[model samples]
Target chain A: MYLFSAHNITKNYAAHTALKNVSIDVSAQTIFGLLGPNGAGKTSLIRIINQITAPDEGELYFNGEKLKPHHISLIGYLPEERGLYKKMKVGEQALYLAQLKGVPKAEALKKLKYWFEKFEILDWWNKKVEELSKGMQQKIQFIVTILHEPKLLIFDEPFSGFDPINVNLLKEEILNLRNNGATIIFSTHNMESVEELCDNIALINKAEKILDGKVHEIKNTYKANIFEIGYNKQEINFNEIVPQSYEILSDIHQNGISKIQIKIPADEMPNQLIKYLIPHMEMHSFNEILPSMNDIFIQKVNEQKQKSF
Target chain B: MIFLFKKLTNRSKNPFKSITMKKIRLIIQREYLSRVKKRSFIIMTILGPVLMASIWIVPFFLATMSDEKKVVSVVDETGVFVDKFESTAKILFVYETDLEKSRADLTKEKYSAVLYICKPTNSIPDHAMLYYSDKSPGIITQSYISNAMQTILKNNLLINAHNISKEDFDLINRTNIKLNTEDIRTGKKSYTEIKTALGIFSGILIYFFIFMYGAQVMRGVIEEKTSRIVEVIISSVKPFQLMMGKIVGIALVGLTQFALWILLTFFIITSLQIAKPDVFKSPKTEQAFDAGQKIPSADQIQLQKLQNQEIKEMLTGIFEIDYGLMILQFLFYFLAGYLLYASLFASIGAAVDSEADTQQFMLPITIPLLFAIIMSNFVINNPDGPVAFWLSIIPLTSPIIMMVRIPFGVPVEQVYLSMGLLILGFIATTWVAGRIYRTGILMYGKKVSYRELWKWLRY
Candidate 1:
């Protein structure tokens, strides 16, 4: 079941329309990546789901019920431009945010203490936010976001300020949150992370959802008929053996092995390419190439821009 | 990981709601406590009372302390004013025969200044040259010599030429006119001068507190916005709630400071009175009458009795002021005024991204306050006039103009009308400010114009 969804959501700010008929479904226990370049209405849709803003014209649902003001406590949002009170102590601020999400003080304290200890930040609980480094502050904010165990979590550019090690740690926590049955909406420009973590994804550009589907299915749909083969028989030239229907994109000889990348014509299939390659050379490896999300994202946005112009 | 799963599976029921009273309370608590614990808040709280007390105490010290006495040598070539310039606490006179010798002495710094009395062109000379080394004598010393010469010339001419009695001349010189007023409605009489003073003092105090604390609220809002913590807090609570939480929290801070100032000032005044009874005691003006000469026993007794009567009237004038009602009205006006202006300040804080952008919006909010202060001077003189009535009834200026009128005992219905309008005004501005604050807080990196603010109001 879809844990949360914003259908036909439209939002405008004065003369500018921030989101127009943007819709997306976030299924339970899955990571939904909201992909877009800057100023593409991604933040607008995320804000609508979080109920930070109401859509100009559409509806939002949480757990199949019409979203209401009271449903905000069930939603946790870490905005792109997020911060803690610079002068506030970390533990105190964390507990305050937890209680603000409807957890009682005693429960919030217990949960915060556990998380702080787990993160190995118990020693810095009394430190003011301004005294911590930016990455450390991001960690504290991350803890605050998940401490309440919100049913729906939305993170906008969550990995921006994090170092590589901490970024990996956060990616682990996000996956962990999804495994625990919390539906997550992750919005970022980091396509690699999206490929690794997101089960379903949507791409928004110019205040419209341009593409969306299960990650693997969308990648397959955008794939070009291409195959990469590596063979130890370095004496054969790829151009002589390949058929006219296939084209060799590149060939490189290294370590007594010849590797060539070939793209077959649209009518060909991956198995035909593989069968043809195996007969011509002692194939150690043969694999068809599927488009990466980054390539598909750039192509789709560019396509939309061209269509509009 | 198991703990996360167990809680998730067990959480079939929803416990969270949007913008709950509980959440607002938490927001308020956070805003209040965080600021109250700040070093700046603590420092200002302690410093507020000291600054207020010094405003009153510093002038008192300066008034009571005497200046060093300066000697002025007089060369009366006219012989018309010899031995006339007597000594006072701040100035002494030394009569000399040779003008050149006095000039030489003045140059040598023996005398602070030399009064070169030219030969009298007429019965009363118009101008006199004062010679000194480099700098002129203080105004007080020069005024003393000028006044003594004027009096000697006028009295001598009146006695010799007009054959006027000395008693009549003295009586004429001492004549002073005072206006007596009685409130027809209350049937209470008072000296107008004292009532005017009470009115001005209370009006200035209200104006001062409102301007001070209202700006504090604005600065607090700017701090939250610039630090970018407002959005995180706003996601949980409505922007209206956040703005209110800040407004009310700072109101409490203002009240705390005001209460401390009142209590501390009272304590300081009381302790000063007890420790040194004469420190604030009003000095007798009889010393001025006794200076330069002596009077007959009969006249002296009569003068003393008259001075005693004047002091009594002054006391009665102060006692006749309705202090109980004035203080109550002061508190009411102060609070209403603060709420009315503070909401506007909060909205301005939200509209701008930083302190630099506040200038455009600040002028409109402050113009009424500035006009109110300037009009209060007029209001004090004509408390019952139409200008005072209108200014006091209008909510924008009422807080100050009304307080000025209250000490002079305004009509009861006018007071009710002003207060009713003030409350209605506060509610209206708060609603308006809440709207602006809601949209403005979420709007980041946008240079807001007046037109944009109006659009936000509609939103």
Candidate 2:
């Protein structure tokens, strides 16, 4: 059973619809990527799930029960925008915010200390929030959000400012959270990270989910019979061995090597081409290219635009 | 299940209400500890009372210590009014010296002034030439020379004209007036007017703090909002709790400062007395003087007499104030008033998203605080009047206005009525403020105005 399900969610910002009949059931202990470009309704749906807002038309279910304010305690939300009290000290402020999230003082402090020390920010406990660098402040915020060990963790562009090393660090922690039986929702425009982290993907374009499925399945579903052929022989005549079922999209030849993109009908798949071409040509490499998440996003968004007009 | 529900539906209980006592404690602690801890606060608080004490004690100190006298070389060519100067204090008469030396001595400030006596002829010059560069001498010194001249003239008149006996003529001129009276009514119990003044003063102090500290709360809210920190806090805590926490925290700070200031004042006055015992000495012959020299002309004299009578009435009225009642009412009104308006200030802080948005709402909140000030003065004049009753019963004005009227002898019924209404107003205002706070803290990027606030209140 899904731990949380947002069924047919619809939200509007005045006259503009931000979410249109969007439904996604996030199962327990899995990382769900709510992937979208800027201005997509990913944030709107997340806000609906968090109950920071109410959907104009939808139902929210938590473990097969209706969601209420109490459900907030079950979710940990790290918003994209950074917010911290400038005059408040880091440790004291973190503890206070954590308590408000329902952890008692001693327990909150215990958890906060562990996170602070783990992040090597124990000395920052006494310093005012303004004294810390942006990354340090974000660490404090992250600790406060996760101190309760919430069941559902929603990260909205969590690693935007992080350098490569810290990015890997945060990525490891995110996976650790999922491993610890916490269902996660990762929202970002960074498709490479999504590919690395996301188990399932929901692509929102123009306030609509144009595509949603397992990451591998979605990549496979959007695939066309496209292959890249690289060869040392530059003067190959594609008309000799290539079937009429295939079309050459791009060709490049330089430095005694040739590279070409061939789109073939699924009936004449890559295996059929290989069968016909091995004797006719000496091939350095022949590979059917799987569509990447970036390519899928671009293709889906363009398809959505064309459909809307 | 019950525990889970308690965690969830604690909604019925005010989200802000849990932090009530602690927030107030923290706020007051912050205000008090921070302010009183500063060296400047300690110095100023201590200095103010010391200055006040010296104001009361310094004159006597001056009169006692002032033994040095001004020596005037009177070149009285005319023998008139030489003896008139005898009544003046702090002046000495010196024998005539060379004109060049006296003029030179005046430059050195050897004498306070040099008096040049001119003979009065049918053509008397409008002014007598004083060798000293100073425009005027002390009245006491001037009177001394005048008295000396008068005595010499009197002696001359008696010697030249009537050849009257000097002793007999002096006997005829002396006279004194005496009076005795009984009050028409006796046993009238009057409150010490100073005590009443103290109450009104405390009331005004409370009034000013409510405005000043209330704005501090507003500014605090604005700071958090401008820095964008409020958004993070709002997500975790209800806006009402946040506002109350801040208000209560700052109020604690204010109370702490007040207590520290009182202690410092006591210290300052004590040190002052110990350091300078002469300040407590009684004056032998010090007198209040007119704004100008001597006296004004006849018409001016009549106007001055009327003004003096008015002043005497005011002094007497102050003397009639009831100290015990005034103090009690002052405490009640101060707390009630501060609590009442502070909520408004807190609400104002919450409504406007940023500091820049505060000015538009500042006038509305500030005007009532000012009205309390104006009404405080008014009710001081007419304590039992209908206007006083009306204003005091209204919780907003009651704190300040009732405090002023208490010394003037407000009835027990009115005090109770005012207190009751003030508490009720607080309950209502807090409710309204909590609503506005919850709404406004979440709202950003919108210009909230009075009309809009009204809409929010309705919502």
Candidate 3:
């Protein structure tokens, strides 16, 4: 069963509509990547799910039941622009935030101690937040978000300020949480992390969802029928031998080896192009080219931008 | 089990109704503990009493301390005043016939000043020019010399015009009376001076708490907003609850500080009283007069005695008040006044992005408080005047003005009405502030204005 879903949510501010009929389903024990460009209503949808804001029209469900206030305790949110009290001690602030999420004070302290030790920041327990570096503060914020052992966690731009090493550590922790039966929804501009971590993604463009599927399926759905061929020959012109069903996109010859990219019609496949080229050229290799999520995101957003203009 | 099931079902149906209390408690705990732990709060709490006790203790200590004797050489050009300047507690007059000799002797540092008493002309010339090398003598020295001359002149005129003896003249001049007012309703008589002091004390106390604690609430909100911790906090608790937590938390801080001040002040005052019982006693005569010099007449001694009696009466009048009830009402008015102003301050804090942005909106909130404080002086003077009555009824000004009238014995119906209206005012402002706070906390980087605040209220 899906752990959470926002069905047809719409939100309007005084001067703008932040979200319009955007719906997303987050499955259990899986990472849901909310992909969008800036100002594409990702935060709006997250806020709606968190109930920080009420949708002008929508319904929310958790585990196939209607969402309610008690569900708030079950979900932890790390907002894009999160902070801690500058003058407050690190452990005290973490414990306070944990208790705010409904964890009892003793449990909060115990959990915070464990997390502090795990992060190797136990020495920072009595230090003020202002005394910590930005990266260190982000670690504290991360610990606060997960200290309650919430059923679902939402992280927005969670990797913005981290070094690569810490980013990898954070990604590992996030995946570990998912493996331990907690659902996660994270939003970011890092398509590489999305490819590495997300099981499912929904791409939003201009307050609307343009693509939604399992990550591999979405990548496959946007792939063109193109193949790259390498031949033993020094040079080759495809104009004479290529059929109308296939056309050469690029041809390059270097050091007695020839490489050519050919696009096939919708009715044709990469195998058919290979079949067409086999008679004229000795094939060293043939491989299909699939678009990355970054290309897909740009193409979809640009296409939607064109459609609107 | 049945009750638990019913509660679960009800909460599921209307969760918001019951979801706020636990969160609000957490927020209040954070605010109160964080502020109480701050070094500034601890320092202010300890310093407040020392400062307040100094107001009453410093003057009394100075009055009772050992006085340095000052000798003034009187170069009396008017022979009628030679050897007539009587010595008092600090000042000693020595007759000097030669003005040049006195002027030359002045540098010896044995004398404080040289008093040149010019002969009385057609009118009482601004008498007695005083000269010193470096420092100027105090006003008391000149006033004392002039007063002695006036007394002698008045006695001479009375003796010549009425053919009366000096004893009769002395008896007539020593008249001392005090005004006592009786309440028509209770038939109880009391001094007007005590009532005025009590009225002003209560009014200023209310005024003080509202300003001090109200600004604290505003500063706390601004800190949360600027530090960007408010969003994390408000996500767990409602904005209204957050605002309320801060308001009540800071109010408790103010109350704690006030209680500490009162307790410490009383302790310090009593300790000093026990340590030096004569600190507040009657003034003593300690000047060294020449053995052959004339002493001050009995009339001058009687005058000093009358002044001492006045001070003793003022002290006794302070003890005559019904302190328990006054303190209870003071707490009520202080809390109500604080609530009313703190809500307005909180809204101002939420509407602005920084402390610098608060200046534009501060005027409207502060005007009524300033007006009430300024009008409280008038209220103390005329507690039954129309202005005082109307101001004590208006919710904004009533918190202060009513306290001023209460110690002078306000009508019971008016107190209840004022209290009711003040509570209503607090609730109304809190609701309005909650609206502004909810909208403004989430809004960042925008320059907010009064018009924007109004729109937020509508939202």
Best DockQ goes to which candidate? Answer: 3
lDDT of 2 by residue, A101-192 (tens): 66767998898889888888899999989898888787787787788888788898989877788888789988998898788988999999
lDDT of model 2 at position A186: 89
Q: What is the DockQ of each candidate?
A: 0.54, 0.31, 0.55
Candidate 1 residue pairs that clash: A70-B18
Q: Which residue runs does candidate 1 get wrong by more than 4 Å?
A: A233-235, A254-257, A265-271, A279-282, B1-19, B38-43, B284-308
Residue-level lDDT for A235 in candidate 3: 47
lDDT of 3 by residue, B1-459 (tens): 335433544554565545567777777788888888889988887888888888978877776565788898988776656665566656778888887788888887867889887877754444667889677887776687678877766665678656999778878988778676777876666667778877887788888888888888998888888877886776676678789988988888778888888898899888988998867554343222232255656776787677768777777667767789888888998998899889889988888888988999989988998899899888888888999989998889998899888877788898898889989998998888888888887788899888888888986
Candidate 2 ranges beyond 4 A from true positions:
A7-23, A35-59, A70-73, A203-211, A253-258, A266-268, A284-309, B1-101, B115-196, B271-277, B282-328, B351-354, B443-459
Query: What is candidate 1's lDDT per residue for A262-287, written digit by digit as tens?
Result: 99988877787776667767788887
Candidate 3, position A196, lDDT? 94
Stretches off by above 4 angstroms in model 3 are A229-233, A238-241, A251-260, A276-285, B1-19, B120-126, B156-164, B284-297, B304-312
DockQ computed for model 3 against the true two-chain complex using alpha carbons = 0.55
TM-score of chain B of 3: 0.89
Please give the distance, in angstroms, between residue A242's alpha carbon in candidate 2 and its true position after superposition: 2.8
| Candidate 2: residue A258 Cα off by (Å) | 4.5
- Fnat, model by model in order, equals 0.63, 0.27, 0.55
